[model samples]
Target: MTSAYAAVYKEWRDDPELFWRKAAKAIDWIKAPQKIFDAGAGVYGLWFPDAVCNACANAVDRHVEAGRGDQAAIIYDSPVTGTKRTLTYAQLQEEVGTLAAVLRKHGVEKGDRVIIYMAMIPEAVIGMLACARIGAIHSVVFGGFAAQELAKRIDDCAPKLVLAASCGVEPNRVVHYKPLLDEAIELAARKPAAVLMLRRPQEPATPTQGRDFDWTAEVEAARAQGLFADCVPVAATDPLYILYTSGTTGAPKGVVRDTGGYLVALEWTMSNVYDVKPGEVFWAASDVGWVVGHSYIVYGPLIHGATTIIYEGKPVGTPDPGAFWRVIEEHGVASLFTAPTALRAIKKEDPAGTWLQRYDVSRLRALFLAGERADPDTIQWAEKILNVPVVDHWWQTETGWAIAANPLGLGMAPVKYGSPTFPMPGYDLSVVDDLGHDAGRNEMGTILLRLPLPPGNLVALWNQEARMRAGYLDDFPGFYKTGDGGYVDDDGYVFVMGRIDDVINVAGHRLSTGGMEEVIASHPDVAECAVIGMNDAIKGEQPCGFIVLKAGTSGTHERIEKELVQLVRDKVGPVAAFKTAIVVDRLPKTRSGKILRGAMKKIADHDPWTTPATIDDPAVLDDIADALKAKGI
Candidate 1:
């Protein structure tokens, strides 16, 4: 079986270009483009040679054609309500196909944008796939985003149809999405044609300005009306989805991903990095707004015919630590993928208590962690608690593909904590020096990919020609600059320090704020830590740490601060010492659980909080800032 799996991988890897060409032959092609090799002009690559295709075909239709229609397509779980739904590949096809007809009947056609405001629900999945199936481009704003945030996306996309949920229960609270959309529509100059609403918890919410159409009624009407929507075969390079990333500077750019290139990259990465197995359960815990959700949650796993889990609600919902375990138990999830933030909390909550004891995780063979760097402590915590080897991989949205992965089915056991371990096949990782030269052994430099083009990375951001050019091409010139600082160790494992700006320069000595957080988290008194640099009269910049202590760990400023400072020094050398360590009850975090270091840094520097668009607890920043100020800056 091992050799057979490898043989399959090798046969495809050896001629992936050929394999993709063949695999795509199954998709219905429209007018084919005439240029597959226009990439020499820098950041402008034409793909699919003018062939027309639907994203849903590769994700669903083809899987059915391969006789895997009985296989599970999606296993959806609601952690807050403890409800579950499973759709088979055939069932998915019918649902998406039916919905595509309804969308077409409603005047959502090719080139039209559809705004999806929803959480992780079957309707949301069906809506996105249905749009892809019928050639309407989708833009999914995160469900946690407020009306102001959703209005920006809606105005930008200018969608013809808005697919939204009435309301949904999150970990701790009920979100009223219909009211938000209604508010946004009321604020809009040109409202969308209609808002198709899902009845979450079957609660009948107030209608949206006479434009609200009940989804259940509409879907049923479409089936009853016997309307079969015609498929509009889009050019392979046609836009599939427009994802917005909060720019480091300026307004959010609509990052457009088209049919062929995007899906090809996603399918390639899923099969290669994760070793996707047909009929096996694959769970990617990301909000649909994120690129991870777009690719893995909707595209990659579905295309592979793997059963993907769409989990709604937070990891720790209400007052239970076993929310995740219950989902795994309910679904019998085989492959689990999540972030280290959730892992850290789970480990902290149940140090020696086996939460996995609650589930039949026998089906769970491989566990992967990404999104951000999972520190050595998180890795060890997972190992001690979960009893499953937590494989850490690294990538970015710009790269499109996972550059570094601990590839499945390969048995090499050099576990370098906090490292991606090795360069994945078909990619090369180099730490280039400031002088545009490669670094020496164990020396840090700007991470650059030796690139003509990798399979998974985008050629450029859509529509913004110069924006794409400046973001990727102009920076490193010939190399894809990753904007990260890392070094390949003597053992050839790549150790990522953090983002270049995330490094603290204290008296001209480069120190990673991430490194300090790792050491601080290891202390028994600490639950989490966020580190940043602040200006000082003398040292130019000083390390300032904001940390949340473990429950009941005496919150006195003098005692906790001294203990943490000494703990870091003892654990990771005096080089890791902070100028001041602050103890707080909470840290500002995104709804996705990423600590808002950007917001914290803004507060520390007296700058505006530009990126805290959907903060879970915005008031946490105030408490943290107050605590930090009490320590005399």
Candidate 2:
């Protein structure tokens, strides 16, 4: 009954029903629902039964009415184009209303789906909030996702309308995404009616016949028609949005999140975890397509009425590494949230910079990193270089908002550098073994959330992929299995070790190795291939492919290798492609022809688990080892 770990969520664990309802008081709800629970004893959440509320209205409307109208909601920048803009609470309300009116003209009704294909521009947030305001679910595909990846999502959702930009700005030159967007539209069977374009980069884009029209013009037309109506009232459990997780499975699983329960959790997270000040400027360096952006960038900041910075360009592009610091100084940014992978990239590009010295980031008091655990070196680098404590928060797409956070300003939990600290106000977190028994101090096992799913947790899966309930929901009965292998130390700090299933994390991106292997093995010359993660100086782990060609494979080493790599690149985009590929005469295998990928990694990292189970062809394993040893990688 006495859990030292869950000092916060202990109230909820004792009487979960009461805790969830009590947590609801944290937010300014439109119509507080009649009941938190619909069914009986063992059954859990149906948060606000038939309650009518809007996510953006919660974010924009309520905060302004609370007399925070002049507070900046988002500080936006397009560094590549040398543009800067800021939206206050009042400004954001107008933008959302205009865009919501635009969607209404395009027939985006309450249950309609709108796919937003834009970079990390403020308009992306504008578009998303617009959809939320009108009760239409918006799915934003990450801009970097290849045409094929985009196409698959488009086909899956079959969204009513699409909101995209004419071009995108990265760190370097302008990336003309129109070509790829056009190509993807060509591929989709039931294509979107029209492509609304936000034309600013001016790249001489000839519209694609009747299917294409200007984005700004359409919104202007909508403004002429009438502003968006008051938020579409719905039950708290009504699906607000559906975000697809990056490829951890063959098919992307759509995580449907509702309005009320989600906002309750996010509002609590912004207040308790970050201890956000109303006027403080907050920047989360993530594209809206990812989960981090969804929570922190859009919902969390607005919930707290903080100035959320949305940078359209990559950090490096804005005059090298000085860009982030400049924004902090310019916008008077109080807090910044980002991933370690991004920090590593910036550090690699600008180690000892004139930028750091020239820029004033005194306004930046705290830093936060999520998506993956922060590397100790990066944490120290942030503290030493920026002279601010880097607060690390850990949670998954399923758990929604900050599950375990090192709340520096709020709770004064001492820093563990790379560790994910204590659970939030309403999460019953436990580390358990295979048999469902709890793990003791410092014992590593699966992280389980004994459920009545947490407030921010995924409610249900989308149509066909609803079977994921078996992969997730039914596993531990009431408890939602996190499926990650992690451990809780004596200090109550959490360190995630990787996924139980062959899900690999390459530079903080979660994906399936078997998913890639399956695509690679389908190639004609490739009889079989096993992908293994090799520790890289830059990326946390670089995936490498070891292959044994089929019979009568005769192409030269250089030629065949290039083709194989291309095959994978085409199959699953550059992200899933192997960093290195080794062609061996025969792969190390058991008598049953199982490739020993673990042994392959043992060449780079001499760990015991990296050792293969048992090899029938041990000599073949030696041959592959000799090849990698020669390369010294």
- lDDT (C-alpha, whole model) for all candidates: 0.74, 0.72
lDDT of 2: 0.72
Query: What range of 10 consecutive residues in model 1 has the weakest lDDT sum?
Result: 1-10
Per residue, candidate 1 scores C-alpha lDDT tens digits across 150-250 of 77777777899999888877665787787788888877666799988887774578765568888888899998988666456787767788887743334
For residue 563, model 2's alpha carbon misses the true position, in angstroms, by 35
State which candidate has the highest lDDT: 1
Assess candidate 1 and give its TM-score to the true structure: 0.91
Candidate 2: tens digits of C-alpha lDDT, residues 302-323: 8877779888765565667677
